[model samples]
Target: MNTRPLLEVEDLRVSFPGTTGEVEAVRGIGFSLGREKLGLVGESGSGKTMTGRAILGLVPPPGRVTARRLAFEGRDILGLDAAGLRRLRGARIAMVLQDPKYALNPVMTVGRQIAEAHRAHGRASGREAERKALELLSAVRLRDPERVARAYPHQLSGGMGQRVMIAMMLAPEPALLIADEPTSALDVTVRTQVLAILDELVTARGMGLLFISHDLNLVASFCDRVMVMYAGRILETCRADALSQAQHPYTRGLLASLPRLDRPAETLPVLARDPRWLDDARADA
Candidate 1:
């Protein structure tokens, strides 16, 4: 039984060079993920997705991802070349984007797209890949697996499309899964179902899960641990159960802003803006 973490990121910084100057999207974020599901919760520009993309080496040109230490399953990923990163992307680590519409190809059948992902990671052949794809769809609790496979992205509803994306991501059986707002586009009922599927898969496979979202209540309930970020810096890291009792000002502010079910107010609390929240010097040290 290896006790080491599956992924460890330390002092990660992602910056983009612009005409005006440089924009630092991620500023020295650090965390370790093991078999448990971890949530990164923040606002839209909080750099949660950027951190996930940096791990996959998906940062586009003009943006540089630098880290003192970035390891996946005990291997240094920061130094991996394009080929190495590609090999690692779907094989050892996989990502489920926020929207399946953009992630999936319009021209390709859902089954073929999943099969291509499997083949890219050296998984199986044509027949075997189709079988595996159906199995994956079934795992995600999708009905009519064969029919769904033959359908295109446009043919499926938002929830179904997301399930298809999940199936494709899980086909490779990666050790780590990064789901960026995986259920954001779905309705409440479908979102619950999709999250349940993800929860079961992670627990059954003992895989590390990086679940990123802006919904604090969802993250608090779903993830084992939670990392609250603001302006690319981690404000607090605590157990999910302790989220309501968070001590950081930013964390408290976020909680205050969330709509309460039992205690309804005429208006939701306004989020206060503080310059110190974005100060990396104070956040890091």
Candidate 2:
């Protein structure tokens, strides 16, 4: 197995030009990813999704993304042109978004959409793409692949739609997958199923996975390592099994806030905000 990281980021900063001044959404943060599951946990507006988007050059116009170093497979992402990034996006890296309702094409059949992804990279002929689409649908554990393939996005349930989205992303056979709250919209049972599929696929393919979500318990339980983010900064990075032993106050607060069945609390404590934490240069890894 290759010991080198699949992606490396250093001092990554993303900002938007605003009327008041430049608003920094993602403050300077650094991390590296190998062919393993790495979870990013934070509340909304903490810049979890933006970090993932910035990695793929999807920060949109007017939002400036800069980094002291940002590289994927030893290639500088900051230097990749439109054409180069296009080839790299879905082929070498892919992202699964929060909701399939918004991610999937409502009018296109599931199979055609998956086939389109496969063909977009010129990876296969039309027939081959179609075959791969069905294979991927099955790979995601969707029963009756033929029927699901013929169905439209709206015709499928939230779980099924998400499954189709995953199948489509898998069509490109990406080496890295950035899943931004992929299971947040699904029910508990379905969420478990979708994650199981993701776990199996990533492990079997030896792909690197960046799992982004706000669920602290979920990240601790599901990911190999967890990065706790607050105010666009990573306060701590620790092994999943050791999340309870996290030294950062923010991480401890998050863990304490989780509702537990075994030990119930009358009320969850409000997370105290500290401006100094934002300026903390130290990362407890």
Q: How much lDDT does candidate 1 score?
A: 0.90
Off by over 4 Å in 2: none
TM-score of each: 0.96, 0.97
RMSD of each: 1.7, 1.2
Residue pairs with backbone atoms closer than 3 Å in model 1 (clashes): none
Instruction: Report the lDDT tens digits of candidate 1 across residue range 1-285.
Output: 888999988899999997899899998998999999999999999999999999999999879999999999899999999899988998899999989999999999999999888887874779998888888888888889989999999999999999999999988899999999999989999999999988987888798899999999999999999999889899888899899998888889889987888889988888788898787333321
Error of 1 at 74 (Å): 1.1
Please provide, for model 2 over 180-217, each residue's C-alpha lDDT reduced to its tens digit, 9 standing for 90 to 100. Answer: 99999999999998999889877888899999999988
Question: Which candidate has the top score in TM-score?
Answer: 2
Model 2: residue 88 alpha-carbon error in angstroms: 0.2
